[model samples]
Target: MGIHQMQSDLRAFARERDWEQFHSVKNLVMALSGEAGELSALLQWVEPGQIGAWIARPANREAASDEIADVLAYLLQVADGLDIDLEEAFTAKLAKNAAKYPVEKSRGVSTKYTELG
Candidate 1:
């Protein structure tokens, strides 16, 4: 289903469970941060080159996937609460990023946009 539909379904799920009371945008954002941290922690200690192997383990992949889902759920809820269109927002932001980080200047480098020149 699409994001709006997913948000609607998620809202209904929360309403049915009476969990909506705790889903204020702030709370949802905090929960999202926690979930993201959990996902990050899953691969934080692995050497960059070994991250593939680390996540390739079935159990680890499952654990990371669960954390990712939690993160997305909370993020969707946050977008719903704020009435933000995630697809539109992402597209606009990506265009802005592309303008700021053009290939000729940004290729093969990690410098911040402000320092790209």
Candidate 2:
């Protein structure tokens, strides 16, 4: 489903459980961070070369997916709380990033855009 629909459904779900009070932007952001950390913890000790292989396992992949969903859920709540349009924000940010990191100077480089000039 689309972001709006998902946000609506999430709001409904939380409303049914009276969880809205707990979903203030600050709380949702903190929860998002926790969920992201959970996902990171799964790969924290894995060697970079083995990272892909480790996540390829069914159990690990499932766990990671769940953590990702948790992150998204909280993120959506945070956005909804702030009345932000995620898609628009993402498009604007991507456009700004592309301008900052144009291909000529950024190609084959990992340097920050500030340092690319």
Candidate 3:
């Protein structure tokens, strides 16, 4: 259920299916993007308020979860391939975002960081 468990399961599934050979970082990244596109397509025409309901629909939720899993699987594979630590990357990104969007200038505002003055 945790990331480590999910990563192990994904690796095991790939090995069982002989898919590791085709799961290089580049290929996995491309597949991850494609899956993200599929997830995005599901909300393309839905209103903001309705999007939540659409996502909550059983079939839609299943599809969304599958796409999310695809993205996560590839991301973990990429980290494993490059020997990078996901926790470190996550922490670094959080710090970077914090610097980019200081609360004094960002709170209660929907504007982008670039527009904050």
Which prediction has the highest TM-score against the true structure?
Answer: 2
lDDT of 3 at 81: 70
Provide C-alpha RMSD values for all models, in order. Answer: 1.0, 0.9, 1.8
- Winner on lDDT between 1 and 2 is 1
Per-model CA lDDT versus the true structure:
0.94, 0.93, 0.84
What's the C-alpha lDDT at position 36 in model 2?
95
Best model number under lDDT: 1
TM-score to true structure, per model:
0.94, 0.96, 0.85
lDDT of 3 by residue, 21-83 (tens): 998888877887887888788778989989788887999988888888777777887787777
Model 2 over residues 34-107: C-alpha lDDT tens digits?
Answer: 99999899888999999789988999999989999999989998999999999999999999999999999999
The C-alpha local distance difference test score for the whole of candidate 3 amounts to 0.84
Point out where model 2 deviates above 4 Å.
none
lDDT, candidate 3, at 42 = 72
Error of 1 at 14 (Å): 0.5
Model 1 residue runs over 4 Å out of place are none
Per model, state how many residue pairs clash: 0, 0, 0
What stretches of model 3 exceed 4 Å from their correct place? none
